[model samples]
Target: MSKQVVFTIKLEPELRDTFMAEAAADDQPAAQVMRELMRGYIEQRRQAREYDAYLRRKVEVARADKTAGRGFSNEDIEAEFSAARDELGQVV
Candidate 1:
């Protein structure tokens, strides 16, 4: 395991009491609970950033496709789906 550093923060008494109580109820230490919460929050933010980048790339590609006349219209999509439905003996 890597060497750990000490960190400290202040919290309101009420909030601290509630957090401690909840941690005790789960049979875990408050520090462990805080660590898990921090890890989860960091992961969620990381995923959100990755998703944003993916969306930006998709939008850029879509814009490039539109400029190159490679984009399809809604009517084209509907027509393609209609044709597929007919071939598969399904109702539109």
Candidate 2:
């Protein structure tokens, strides 16, 4: 099932003509071009927003660890890696 909704937009004559011209150039309908533009814009915004949030979270965690002096030694990390690799047969 599909729902039908109506939206109204105000655009200048030049932009409208430009949209139509571009649509013709692509051999696609103006509505299709508009839909593609909207979907791409929305998807890009979502990805950017999520990545921004992830970076912010990582920075906050790193800052907290820095203030608390919470860290692992290189030898400790290497030992853990070696054990996991030896057990899992995934690395040397």
TM-score versus the correct structure, for each prediction: 0.77, 0.69
Cα lDDT over the full model 1: 0.92
**Candidates' C-alpha lDDT:** 0.92, 0.87
Worst 10 residues of 2 by lDDT: 1-10
Q: Show where candidate 2 strays beyond 4 Å.
A: 1-3, 71-92
Residue-wise C-alpha lDDT for candidate 2, range 1-92, written one tens digit per residue = 25376556899999999989989998999877777898999999999999999999999998899689897778989999999889888643
In candidate 2, which residue pairs clash? none
- Per-residue lDDT, model 2, residue 80, is 99
Please give, for residues 1-92, the per-residue lDDT of candidate 1 as tens digits.
36398778888999999999999999999888888898999999999999999999999999999999999999999999998989888642
Query: How many pairs collide in each candidate, listed in order?
Result: 0, 0
Q: Write out the backbone clash pairs for model 1.
A: none
